[model samples]
Target: MIRPSGRTDSRLLWPIAIHPFTGTVEVVFQHLKRSPPLDDEPLRRELMTKLNEIEGVDLAEAKLDLRPSFPVEVFAEHSEEICAVPEWFAHTVALAEARRMPDGDPGTY
Candidate 1:
């Protein structure tokens, strides 16, 4: 069983899940750890948009499905949504991450 903390933080985060074979992407927006979580669909979409733009190709927009977390005692976590990401979303994310890294970083060692 999966357990959630039911707590949130100021730093918003989302995990990008991709299908290795199908190339399908699903982003999970979770609650923060320092503060409480709110049903912030607009915030989620806004952040997602920034990431999606990296694809640089006109593709299908994300279809948000609002689903708040369940009971605290059971599963205390923010809701998640499944969206159709561009076919090149994965490559775009990789490029974006790589660009942020320096030409000489400890990870290179």
Candidate 2:
């Protein structure tokens, strides 16, 4: 789910990944737009609270990942750099991708 942060105009993208074996969930928050520095903590707290409200869910045990949107300069610097993917981003992508594949093995993928 993607929503605008009420505290600011910035948008937040929440991607959820579920572990088939353990039934564990992973939530990632990616900032889609830049906002004032002062709003960071409050915004994060708000997001966390909202996430906790999900039913049949364990927010505490869920793996949480937060990251900023890629800077425009990265694209100008290099073609591949256009995507400023963090190290953890790959893990999240892999998990998401695996979830979509036929007979996807969540435990090993």
In Å, residue 105's CA in model 2 sits off its true spot by: 40
Error of 2 at 12 (Å): 11
The whole-model lDDT of each prediction reads: 0.35, 0.37
Predicted structure 2: lDDT: 0.37
Off by over 4 Å in 2: 1-14, 29-39, 61-109
Question: How many residue pairs clash per model?
Answer: 7, 0
Which lDDT tens digits does candidate 2 get at residues 1-109? 2223222211222333444565344444433223332124554444455444433333442323353222233234453422223223344444544554457554331
Residue 21 C-alpha lDDT in model 1: 61
Candidate 1 stretches greater than 4 Å from native: 1-5, 9-13, 29-38, 56-62, 66-109
Q: lDDT tens string, model 1, 1-106?
A: 1115332222233434444465334444443111122134554555456444543222234343322221221111212222233323334434444554467342
